[model samples]
Target chain A: MKQSQLIKGVLEGCVLAIISQGETYGLMQALHHHGFPSLVGGTLYPLLAKLEKGGDIVSIKKPSPDGPARKYYMLTPQGKETFQNFQHQWSQLSGHVNQLIDEVHSNDENPGHPG
Target chain B: MTKTQATLDEINRLTEQLAPADQAYFTDLQLYLSTAGLFYDEAQLNDQLLNMLLDLREANQHGQSARAFFGNDPQTMGNHLIQQFPQPKLRDQLGLFSLLLGISWVFQILSSPQTAGGLSLNLVAFILVPILEICAIILIIRILHTSIYPNNHHQWWPYLLTGLIVTITISLIVILNSWVTVGWTFLIPDPWHTILLAAMAIGATVYLLGALLHRWRHHQA
Candidate 1:
């Protein structure tokens, strides 16, 4: 699969995981600091809106210590539920992928070890 | 320019180069960040905006278009934003359908010749027309309320209740008009009977066609 396509699938799950920690500063910041620096506001904001619409997350305006009131997004009950589901799916899928990678590495070390 | 002023200048320059629609997207993002983010200070907000511009510049240098950096074009993103909110167009179309039904019924009543002892075109219209009009108004209100508030399939209740009421009302009007226009002595006589059937058929067909179009557009989203 294309690299961007691969990142696209897991990006939302990662964003949800970040929000699951606590209310986010800005989801784009979380994504950027987490190593997905290529993502921009145009992509991130719309995803946040879509997630809010789907009831996965909700935003509330709160007074900021130094600036204008900021909208902070917290995971809704539905969001937590979806995050748990993604966690389980990712664990299972990654476990199988890891196993295949390990097999490939082992085979390279001992080329004639297995038929 | 100082570092801060230089960042602002670069942002302005890049923004000026964008197509109007893309520029609108940049404006929307600015508004959103300004209103929503827990920025430590105004400086942080500016830094974030600067970062976004720098990312765009980097993407451009790497041979990616501005839209590629954004991942989707502005129009597609705008549509996604809209789909999160229920459209007013649905209610608008409902109004149009109600108008069409009213006009067709009025035409059916006025054009038919009078018969002995049957309810006159004026009476059927006077009695049922207002009721139908009221029903249409209620239906529109219900649609607006449910869409604005968004309470699950509770939204569907207004639709179902109003739909059932409208269907029953139209049937009663058709059956009554058919009775009176044919003759008071006859229950469901010839030409008016056929006309009533035709009206019902046409109304149902038109309504279904409208609903199908709505579904198709939404599915494309």
Candidate 2:
């Protein structure tokens, strides 16, 4: 039941990245649509607090389509930088792993070992 | 159509999983709304409740008293609050209920006769209570997900699930009486289960009655 340290970073990082693209509400809805249900209305409070405190997020009081003011969160330029850095690191790691996997698959098919 | 009725329904939903004292807070909110020239109606009531929730969240976010201290207009403040409110849930209910049940479960397992805690002065239950408390927590989350969350697809299903789960979990000790008897002969049987169940039943009864009473009082007004 323990989430790996990597997954935790990825999930939280992805949330911030998604928020950088738009408002928090839409980000939450998009996450849910993508089957990441971490926005259980409970998990978000602390995560938002942490992200804001970390200077990776900011919230503005904005009106919604329904005529109510909601707090909309977006990334600052610094946050965008953080997002890009994290994305690059993650892609580098995953890409290397993928290449290794592909090499092993091709090796298995070729059976280069002496018979 | 009245704001009061709308507020009542809205408050009912927001504070649905809250206690009588917590419910009273919403009544105080109603009084505030009625002061703003809003005829108490269900729609405006929902609006008010939503506004109050936003106000509370704002207070939490900024660590201030509704952000304006005191010099602001009430209706303007209220409308501003609604523009930024999030949907409400029973976070308070879940917290208190989880805590109480957690204490109870820890008491049961630690006070378990076969355990070393039961063999001694049961101080071990106090110690072991915290140790196993982590697992109880995980179990509690699992319980909420399996036994309670599926019902949240419906509007009132969460309420029913909260009531149902609380009732059933409190009854676990009763149903486990045989196991306790066989496992530990010297441990005296406790009635906390029955007491909590009875208390819960009465609380539910009083709440429903209180709703009707409020309705009657509002009519008389």
Candidate 3:
């Protein structure tokens, strides 16, 4: 699958996880710091809008020290639940994928045994 | 001023503080988002845009350009943002339609030739022309909107086709007004014509105020 498609699938969960930490103002920067460096405001803002629309997150405008009001996003109860579910599902999926990769690595090491 | 107007004014003010390149990019994105449709929740869209502008300014302070901070493809991002906006409520659509129709009706009444007896109008043409004109306007807006993005190709043909269609529709309306006199006619004597115009003007004003109030309340919430 294309890398963007992969990111698309998990980006929502990643956003939820980030918001679940605390009220987040600079979401794009937060996502970038958290390892999704390629994410941009163009992508992040719409995703945040969708999450707000879906009732998973709420944004409150707070006065900024140096500019106009900034939108601070916080996870709703529904968003917290969603993040928890994502965590559980991610753990299971990663575990299965890791086990499969390890098995394939062992098979490759023992080249003649698999055939 | 209404909350929406206040928000828009603030947006414009903040937008000016952007660097020239960032200002240009923000203007393009603003046009794309605002012209995408008539039915989306505009107040919410403005709020989102204001927040975005603020973010862009902050990024610029840290040495990032708008394109760098917001990504290169604004069209795709704009589409995604618009998709998430709440669609206009059905009542709001009906209210807008009524206001448009009311304004058209008043104009038609006032513009029609007045005579000693009364003013006569071809009812069929009077009703059909306004609807067609409204539809034509919406189509023209959509056509113009799609051409706003620089990356969009196949632009000239759409404009040409739209111009041709609009010209034909307008000509048809004019012909119907001038030549087609066979349809049912309506007559309003001088006194009643004045009253009818007054009534329509009032109705349109009410609808306009109601819509503005609704938008203000929605923004507050």
Choose the strongest candidate by TM-score: 3
Candidate 3, residues A1-115, lDDT tens digits: the string is 7766788888999999888889888777788888888888878888988999999999998888776677899999998888999999999998998999988998999988872
TM-score-best of 2 and 3: 3
Q: Per-candidate TM vs. native?
A: 0.43, 0.35, 0.86
Write model 1 residue lDDT over B1-221, tens digit each, in one string.
Answer: 34455456656777786666657657655554433312123443455565455555445566655566676554455344444543345565567656766765656555545555342454464356556655665565545433433436565665676677778778876665565443333234556656776787788799999889866875685
Q: Rounded to one decimal, what is candidate 2's iRMSD?
A: 12.5
Task: Mark the regions of model 3 whose C-alpha exceeds 4 Å error after superposition.
Answer: A1-3, A108-115, B150-159, B197-221
Name the better of 1 and 3 by TM-score.
3
RMSD of 2: 18.6
* Interface C-alpha RMSD after superposing true interface residues, each candidate, one decimal: 5.7, 12.5, 0.9
Which lDDT tens digits does candidate 2 get at residues B74-136?
A: 334333333333333467445655666665554554444453322322333333434444444
Q: How many backbone clashes does candidate 2 have?
A: 16
Query: Each model's DockQ?
Result: 0.17, 0.02, 0.80
lDDT, model 3, position B1:
61
Q: In model 1, which residue pairs have backbone atoms overlapping below 3 Å?
A: A71-B36
Ranking by lDDT: 3, 1, 2
Candidate 1: regions farther than 4 A off: A65-68, B1-72, B87-221
* TM-score (chain A only) for the predictions, listed in order: 0.88, 0.74, 0.92
Q: How well does each candidate reproduce the native contacts, as fnat?
A: 0.42, 0.00, 0.91
Instruction: Give the per-residue lDDT of model 1 (tens digit) for A1-115.
Output: 7766778878788989999999875565568779887875566756776788789988765666643345677999999999999999999999998999999899999899952
